[model samples]
Target: MALFPPKNPVPTPTPVPMPAVTKPSTLPPEDINRAKQLGTCIRARFAQTLVGQDNLRESLITTLVAGGHILIESVPGLAKTTAAQTLATSVSGSFKRVQCTPDLMPSDLVGTQVFDFATQKFSTQIGPIHANFVLLDEINRSNAKTQSAMLEAMAEGATTIGGQCIALPKPFMVIATQNPIEEEGTFNLPEAQMDRFMMKAVMTYPTAQEEQRMLTMLTHLGSDTFDSRTLTGDVVSISDVEFLRAAARRVHVSDAIMKYAVDITATSRGAGTKPVQGLSTLVRLGASPRASIALTRIGQANALMQGRDYVIPEDVKAFTHEVLRHRILLTFEALADGVTSDQVVDSIVQAVPVP
Candidate 1:
């Protein structure tokens, strides 16, 4: 023991708990089984009825299980309305079809007040918006006021009558169709109104084989009532849809991915650098923060549809076209130069790197 003030003891270093790096959950076997079964059921039904449209079928399943609205854009007779109506029938939910026109009114879609002679008071009458599933055919044919009425219901999940609010049914989702060819009699969907839709899908012409199949089916079903065909009620339900929504909210999105979304949107607006995709030059408006949130939510649902418990870069990439295309607005110059919303979305997806 050579003294040096007894060699002052170094205080034991207190161990600080390192922040936990949470691991993303792997796909649960049970969820995978259920999702696959649901996918199979949807395919079996859609395959017999619709020819070609692999993309449409997949997107429809994703949208349905994800609890989001869909917008189908196409020329008339492209099966846009038929596809929507088929899905509504398969879901076994209350389905209402509203043929949008210039004369359509707000009260027409969301109901109005009626006088009750017996009770000597006004009673609230519900509208087609109260259904679990809606087919808004040729939505662009409506005037601005009528469009606004539909938009308000889609955004708020409720309708107002006589200053009173009535909540819509559970699992409420709209499948709207627009004829892109006729612009003269139609009102363009407002940018804000377009953003309310979770997905914007274009319905293109089917292949030769698909067309043959469609023609054959139509010929066989002639003079028969199509209304008799019904879907199984137990396979899916409004309550089940609510549960899927809850599960979607729980899907984990990494911070790296979040930053990627922010950077992409920022780049579009020329926030700190030269614009990408000629976005600053062509776009009068960029997507709002709501677009980011919608993307993440739909991405999660897309993942779950694929039997994954966590979202991957692929999920985000697959859905960007549908989620962002309608949100971005192009200037007149951009339209003249053949720049469309889909082109801008494609540019953003290419510019943003995945984690």
Candidate 2:
């Protein structure tokens, strides 16, 4: 006892408690109505600004309501990035845009551990991926490593760093863009990257009348004064998205429609003798099982947007092109015959007998 008492005893410190993990809250019925109203408002606002790009506007709203990601391929100066940010801001969702370059790093996306000089400890510094809505602008311009880093966040909905796993904010969606006109020095997305998207939307130029309207608007407001976002009055809150997403969950999908969805995806496999004569010859790689799931989810969202209690075959058909366009890889023969993936998808739809 005397020998032990001579030495000072060390005291143990209390452990710091970790925060409790909780699931994201659900949206109430009232919030769902508000979300639908907000979707209409944003769609109208974007349509006026984007000019004759109704298809693109529909794609944006559909993808957002569906809680899915979209990849847009278009020429430059079409407001692709601007539209993405405006959509995010219009919905009160935090927007982050990453202008991809060849040298961007993974830390530039999922964040990194930074050493605090004063605290003498490493602190976590989150990157752009933390936002509710993220746009990887010119995604193909970035190298493969950067692309993979982005895909990780999209696929897993979380990122691991420094022996810790962090979940992204709920209702997270990624809208990446690619410039099709530019072939030089652009890193094409691999098959894996394409599979992650729910749709591939192509933005075409405005029609003659729409272009005239745009020019008139430009002349009247002037480039310096015209602000497209000004039209998006009464922005939708993120909570509204939560409610609408909940509503989409309640939308009924019948067994007949379920079989129809499966058949569409199955035809994409290019296996077995089907009504479409050259179906297997056209595709080098067909849609996967994920496409089937996406088709159904997107169908439900479409029905909900239309104020319907159940999904119809038309809902599946409406989104099939967008769902399968990016997923199909046309064979050399298909390309040689000028048979676009869109055409092949149409052929498959025609071949498959509707239940």
Top candidate by lDDT:
2
Inter-residue clash pairs, candidate 1: none
TM-score of each: 0.86, 0.87
Per-candidate clash tally: 0, 0
Residue lDDT tens for model 1, 123-210? 9999988999999999999889988889889999988899998999988999999988456687788877898888888878888988
lDDT tens per residue, model 2, 1-355: 4655665777889899999955334445565566568678888667545666777777788888888899998888776876776577667777788999899998898899989999999999889898899999999999888888888898999987676788999889998989983567686798998999988988878778988887786676556343545663677788888877777777778888888888888888865236467777888888998898888888888887776767899999988998999899988988888998889889889887776
Name model 2 segments beyond 4 Å from true: 1-35, 224-229, 272-275
- What is the Å distance of residue 201 in model 2 from its true position? 0.4
Candidate 1 lDDT (Cα, whole model)?
0.78
What is the RMSD, in Å, between candidate 2 and the native fold over all Cα?
Answer: 12.3
**lDDT for position 247 in model 1:** 66
